[model samples]
Target: MKQGLEPAARFAADLAAVWPEDERSGSLGLAVSGGPDSLALLLLAHAAMPGRIAVASIDHGLRPEAAGEVALVERVSGERGIPFTPITVKVAPGNVQARAREARYAALAQWARAQGLGAVATAHHADDQAETLLMRLNRGSGLAGLAGVRSRSTIEDSETILLRPLLGWRRVELAEVVAAAGITPAYDPSNANADFDRVRIRQALAEADWLDPVQLAASAANLAEGWQALSWYAELDWHEMVMRDPDAHGGLGFTYCANVPRVIAIETLLRIIGELGGHATRGEAARAWERLWAGENASLGGVLAVPSVERVEKVGVAMRVWRFRPEPPRSAGH
Candidate 1:
């Protein structure tokens, strides 16, 4: 029991630290994927804080056996005497996985709000943290992108907080926990698709002798420390200097919010790119930002060119915003 409880104790400590504040009723929501990662979380959470927790699973309905998987989760929850709720999601086309993830969290948030849950916990381990950092690096993300997924946060306009309990644990440790508990863990098939960037990373890591889970977990911890310092500085600047208008220039106005540190600028730009129906990478933010600073950022599609219209006239005094979309794609007949 001590060995089995090792990883669980560490994870539970992380959760309790991030979620120290108690709610009126002291209820917590658990996001279960039916994998060892989350199953372990359920078991550990039970051991760590016995009375205040409940479970919820989001079924993205993409896989053929997804509903069966949900049933398995319910069975496990029932066996453990935990209350469970399953939310089914219909994923949209184009970037299906990302959309599915967003919908899953949104559903969880709604469900938690309804249940009067104070915080929602997930089993995002250290390996996932490293992968996200690498992905953001490959995408030319800036510091905030490099900072990776947060361990604790709240969804916008919601009372429920997100707590990642296993951010310090490795996948190897989790596998051991599952084995010790005599549980069968479900693997997410989407994790192996070669077409996805993250899967490519996983495959590359698998072939390396030095890519042991422990080493990867250590490296991720280092990255997280660096990211924490960078994020602290960024938050200071964001609150003090940046101004944002969601509707400005069809959301390209997020560019004008770049008055403070470059970190806030990039985060705001990330939000803007999503609003503009385009995926903006860190490189993309740098590209757009360079133009904005030099007075040559393209000024089309209700997007503003910061400073002024006339290059010579008090450059920083006049702010110019225009609505310009790149020429529409040609029709099939054309």
Candidate 2:
């Protein structure tokens, strides 16, 4: 078992390193799920931050025991004299896990905003980061996807930050912290369900003596640094080489010089499509990139990319332009 106060001190130090100075006066919202990981976070955060923390538990309503699990967290928060709020969110159909996650974060963001909190903290530890990296790797993800969970991030478009203070701590260490605190956390049965890919990955990692969560999490952090560098260069290229097409009908098109590097061109096109509310998968984007590279017109994600002639210094030159035109809505019973 680990020393209880040591974990609390470590969590505080991590938070102090990243906590924005402008938000020093604001309280933080903690998302606790009554599991060992989140419960350990709640206890540690309370010790470190004291009365400045607001606790919240999101009930996805997918399982019969979810309400009871949330109640357990509420009871613990009450014992610690921390204000607790229980939030219930409805999970929509299609992709249950993804939908549930979106709903949970949406609820948490809304609650944090209402409470006037500056940020919401979650209990994603090093083991979770390792699992995320493996999952993305299995899907042949790019560098950005392989970066796994970030220590701090914005939830969608919200200004309220999402902080993962325990990313440096291992799962067993958290369990030990909970045990040292004399707390019995409610177990979530889904964690052991082999049908979930994450559970299978976690089991495999547990059985593999050669794999270490600390090393995997470190690799993910390194990839995150590389991803940041790529994004920085992409943004610089976008500003220098891209502009609004003056001839486009009502400013619907984006024009870019053809002399930019191939990678920057692809990144600029993707960003333009995203800004225009177009949804394109990685495969679709890759195909579009190839078409553009071949000097052929391409259409994807409700956007069309075509070669254009522009007069520069009284000389007509070839340029690439993307126009945003969404497809018409389908009528019922065609």
Which candidate has the highest lDDT of all? 2
Scored against the true structure, residue 185 in model 1 reaches a CA lDDT of: 78
> Which 10 consecutive residues of model 2 have the lowest summed lDDT?
309-318
RMSD of 2: 3.2
Q: Candidate 1: which stretches are off by over 4 Å? A: 1-5, 21-25, 156-159, 212-285, 306-334
Whole-model Cα lDDT per candidate? 0.68, 0.83
Query: What would the TM-score be for candidate 2 when compared with the true structure?
Result: 0.90
- Count clashes in each candidate, considering only residues at least 3 apart in sequence or on different chains: 8, 0
Candidate 1, 188: how far from true, in Å?
Answer: 2.9
Q: What is the lDDT of residue 187 in candidate 2?
A: 93
Cα lDDT tens digits, model 1, 254-322, are 423245455555555544455555565666666676676565745333233343343223245444332
